[model samples]
Target: MDNLPISSKYRSRPLEPLGDAEREQLAERLNDEFARGGIDTDAYRAMLDQVFAANTLGEVASVVASLPAKDTFAVPVVIETGTAAPGELLPARTTGLRAPLLLVAGLGTGIAVAILLVVLIIL
Candidate 1:
């Protein structure tokens, strides 16, 4: 039986080895789950071991599969002081233009004439 080749089902490598970047990301995900108490110390250590030994992204994904997904977006809450903390993401600003534009358009010709009169009076 020594002459028999190893069975393919148990013998060869099927997945690429995990890289540093992927390892770091998996560690961070594991930390997030641990911090959230989703996994206890023993489980965290076990999963972390899996992450370090992981051969592929699929393996890393399986390691985190039992934990709740981490929230990707963080909304920064600001106080009335209006100063944002360091590293906080600022909310977007938009001009309040659309409502006034639609109102002016709907008022029709009489408002247009009145606006023209105001400009003429100013001139």
Candidate 2:
């Protein structure tokens, strides 16, 4: 069998200081990779700006680390369209349900938890 090249040897890029064209190429490649990874383009651009603002290689690495890690799992989105029979009242209401329900439930839960915690501390 023929000998195969080492993966590390193929993977390593030259470490010489980047020139203007090289920097632009690198940025383009990074943006492409970010987009392919399903990242928000605007957020990635903001992160790129932060990376450029970094003075040192270490600072750039820190900026990269500070950006949220790419999501590992792909969630398949299901768009559901409901059609009700003519003149039938749909019990599930979408309008104003989300914010109001969430706010009320959160506030109620928080109050209950606070009361419980206070009672526990007193007892």
Candidate 3:
């Protein structure tokens, strides 16, 4: 019927002629779905307006189908590091020295302290 909305006709059959009210109702349904997903009402309204203005039933259906149904989730990401080069895998090098240097320093310190004490006693 000419008086009925286009959306209802479209729903019933693709070839059916659509009326303005049905188009508006379908747009509203799309907007409502988007709003439920936390999209701002004003933005949803604008999108609905665009959907309503679509000339073809296919275009209107496309817009309605585009509405997000639920919260979107991203896939977890993983970072991979390549293997180290031959010698580079070894522990870091220290500037001061290791066991040999520590032994020398310790002996020198002990001698220096002993000499100082002897000199003090003599004085």
C-alpha TM-score for every candidate = 0.42, 0.29, 0.33
How many clashes does each candidate structure show, in the order listed? 0, 0, 2
Each model's lDDT: 0.70, 0.55, 0.63
Tell me the tens digit of each residue's lDDT in model 3 across 1-123: 333245443344655454687687676667677757756767677767766666655445545445543333776687545587755665566666688898999999999999999999999
Comparison by TM-score, 1 against 3, better one: 1
User: Lowest lDDT 10-mer window, candidate 1?
Assistant: 1-10
Candidate 3 — which residues are off by over 4 angstroms?
A: 1-16, 38-46, 68-123
Question: 1-123 in candidate 1: lDDT tens per residue?
Answer: 122224321123226567898688779888988898888999899989988987765565556556565556777786556688987888888758988887778888778899999999999
The candidate that wins on TM-score is 1
Candidates in order: C-alpha RMSD to true structure: 14.5, 18.4, 20.2
Query: Of 2 and 3, which scores higher on TM-score?
Result: 3
Worst 10 residues of 2 by lDDT: 1-10
Which candidate number would show the highest lDDT if scored against the true structure?
Answer: 1
